[model samples]
Each structure stands twice: as C-alpha cells, then as structure tokens.
Target: MQDVISKLVKVQELEMRATKVSASDAEVIKALRKGIPDPILAHYDRLRIRGKKGVAIIRNQVCTSCHMGVAIGTIVTLKQGKDIQLCGSCGRYLHLPPEPASETAVAMLPAKPKRKKRAAVRVPDAS
Candidate 1:
C-alpha cells in the first residue's frame, strides 16, 4: 500500500513537471516521500498485473480484480476505507475502501426505531 502511494506520488510529481515544474509540486513530492521513507513494493504491482504494455483488464462496470460485474452492494462497501472488502460476487482483490461518513451520509442513516409496548392479552373468561 505504501509502495502504491509512493509510486502515485512519483507519478504526480512527473505530471506536475510535465505541466510546469514548480517548487510547490516538489514540496508535495518531498513531503509524501518523507512520510513514506521506505516503500514495500506490492507483489501484484501494476506492471505485473497489466504487464509492460499495460492492458485494460477492466472497463465500465467490470471489476478487474474479480473479473465479474461488481455488485451495487460491493460498490457501496468500497466507499469506506483505504482498502475495500473483496467482492462477494468475485474473489479478486478490491482496492477501494468504504467512503468516510459525510453530512449526507449521516442524514441517510435510518431513524431510530420507536419502542413499542406489547398489550397484555386477556384470556376469555371461562364460564
């Protein structure tokens, strides 16, 4: 994960350079590098996954990880954290985590259920 972030930082730096090459970009890169001094390269790196040329393993709604149609539930689950839960639909590893709670999210929560009292059942009077 750290490796991926580090690589992303590097790529962002390169992009920034291609655009204008400013000290701000350098600072951003430096900060990210400092935070992640050592990067552990993931065995399933992008290069290994797509190969040198890079292939569009997934597009549209298909999940490259699972090679299946990602369920709506799976998509919602991935919105939470840095690492998302593997899809129930497929076993392939998922990258996105559940998304952080937002204002709308808080609002979306179901309202608390009101406690209901059970009325005592009267047995019919025996003659």
Candidate 2:
C-alpha cells in the first residue's frame, strides 16, 4: 500500500516536471486525496498467494512459491487485512499491481509482461 502511494507520488512529480504544472497547496491536497492505496487492485480481490523469503513454504496443496499450504491463521490474516504478508514459498513478490483505470486511464496497452528472453533464447542451446 505504501509502495503504491509512493509510486503515485513519483508519477505525479514526473508529470509536474514534464509539464509546467505548478502544483498549488490545494492541488497538492487533492493529489494526496487521490493518492493510490492499491496501485494494481481497485477492490480487495488483489490478494494473491505469493512466496516470499523468511516464511515457510507449504507443499502439495501448498503455495506454488512456498510449496506449502497457507496456514489458517495466515489465511485469516490475508483476508482480514492485518498487515502485508508473504508466502512461505519462493520469496517472489506478491500482491497485484493496482487496477488500472477502467476506460480512460489505460487503453490499447499490452497486457503481457515483456521479457528480454528472446535474445537469451536465441543463443544456441548448449548440449
């Protein structure tokens, strides 16, 4: 959540810098009000089981990242919004990026994560 807000502030700052928008105190307040809470998710459905460092991973029905089934207590915490939690698995970052603006904010944008693997894969496979 804090990360999302910080990113938004950076974006706003960049925009102001790019243009000559001298943000006023009132405008600043408005921008703060518009501060992003969940930059990737609009609603609370953004919760996802992602593995992270420190926590134990579950296997089988466990987390893909952690390889452990999330505990009941942790599950409760995830749904209840106690605090930022990580998966017991792979330690990769969890949570979804804030939901983009439905109609206007983003349009004709690619929905795929770009990768530099093409060049890497182009190399002949070492037998």
Candidate 3:
C-alpha cells in the first residue's frame, strides 16, 4: 500500500514539474493519473483542493506535515508497511524513509579520545 502511495507521490511531483514547463504536459499528467487507483487519486485531489499535501513523511514518530507526534504502535505499523496509514492529526498519508547505509557505517567508527583540561598557573606576588 505504501509502495503505491510512494509511486503516486512521485507521479504527482513529476506532473507538477511538467506543467510548470509546458502546457502540452497536461496530457502526460492525465496519463499518470490513470495508473493511480481512483479512490486514492480522488482523495489526493480533495486534499489538494483543501490546500494540503496528499502525502507526508514520518520522522521521529512525528508527522512532518502536521508537526504532531504519532503513537508508537501506529509508527511501528507504518514501518511494517502492512497497510495504508494516515496521520491522525492532519489526515495525510505517512511514509518512513529508509536509513542510509553510511549512517550505520559511521556509527561503528571509533570515538575520538577526550583531551584533559590544563590546570591554570598562578604568578607569585612580590612582597
């Protein structure tokens, strides 16, 4: 379900970019819309009419569009990608980005040693 949503989001973004370049691109947008499920597409159109994004990324268990935290159970379900999940607060589709390979590799690197602070020296005063 999430995969379908991802593809639809990509198509929508492409259509938006295409329309900005040439009016002839309207045909391409129409073709892209045909591939999406009618219900999902209709929902997306409704959201657009309401001036909100149809899809939103989930980061740190929070919905990026609404800036509201999602419950842990819902986050787990979204990560599993078993079903379509919508943000309770803003009603936008939720997607979790895959963690980068470099991040895990960097985490395994050795930590830098801490340096000790030098003690302050005091000058003796002449009597």
Candidate 4:
C-alpha cells in the first residue's frame, strides 16, 4: 500500500514537472502509472484534470490539501500501511509523512507561545 502511495506521489511530482517544461519526463511518468492500479489511476486522473492534487500529505493528523482533521481510524490504517486512506473532506488520497528521528530531539526544542485572544469591545449605538 505504501509502495502504491509512493508511486502515486512520484507520478504527481513528475507530472507537475512535465507541465513546467517539455515532456522530458513522459517515459518515467508512464512507467510509474503502470505500477498503480487502473481504478486508482483513474481517480487520480479525475482530480488532476480538475487542477487538484491527486495525493495529499497527512501532517499532524490533518490532511494538508483539505486542512481537515483526519479520522483516527484512517490514520491507523495509514500507519499500518495495510490499505490506502483518503481525506474525507477533499477526497484526495492520503499519505503520512515520515516522522522525525527522535521524539527527544523534538521535545528538547523550545515551544512557541500561544497568542492571547483579544476581547471584543461593544460598540455604542447611534441615536
């Protein structure tokens, strides 16, 4: 499953590159497409045709494309690499980015302070 997702991501990147220049990556993109299933490729093509990304990266348990929180079950399935996951909001395929090497390294970093919310002032009504 992860392999399929990786291929999809690569295909997307290659296609994006192809758009910026000549069809130099045509062969590579074709080969990558062969590895992906037809139904999956068809769905990806539908999204791409609409100028939307076919695959979305999952960061902090959220779909980057849709900015919507991903369901826990979806995340679990993605982590297990047992099946493909899709963002419920945007319908794009989801891939979990690789985690940082060490949690301690991240924990040792300083945390950013949260901004305080400003209270709204009531406006006086004009007589």
C-alpha RMSD by candidate, in order: 16.2, 15.3, 14.3, 8.6
Q: Between 2 and 4, whose lDDT is larger?
A: 4
Highest TM-score model number:
4
Q: Across residues 13-100, which tens digit of lDDT does each residue of candidate 2 receive?
A: 4444543545564476356546555433232123222211222222332445434444444433433444544454443223323333
At residue 78, give the lDDT of candidate 3: 58
lDDT tens readout by residue for model 4, 5-52: 999999898887645634657777888899999999999999999999
Which residues of candidate 1, in runs, are more than 4 Å off? 1-20, 40-77, 82-127
lDDT values for all models: 0.41, 0.38, 0.66, 0.79
Residue-wise C-alpha lDDT for candidate 1, range 47-67, written one tens digit per residue = 335432111122333566435
lDDT winner between candidates 2 and 3: 3
TM-scores of all candidate predictions against the true structure: 0.29, 0.26, 0.64, 0.76
**TM-score comparison, 3 vs 4, better candidate:** 4
Model 2: residue 32 alpha-carbon error in angstroms: 14
- Would you list the clashing residue pairs of candidate 1? 78-97, 79-98, 79-99, 80-97, 80-98, 80-99, 81-97, 81-98
Model 2 residue-pair collision total? 22
* Candidate that would win on lDDT: 4
Ranking by TM-score: 4, 3, 1, 2
* Whole-structure CA lDDT of model 4: 0.79
* Model 1 vs. true fold: TM: 0.29
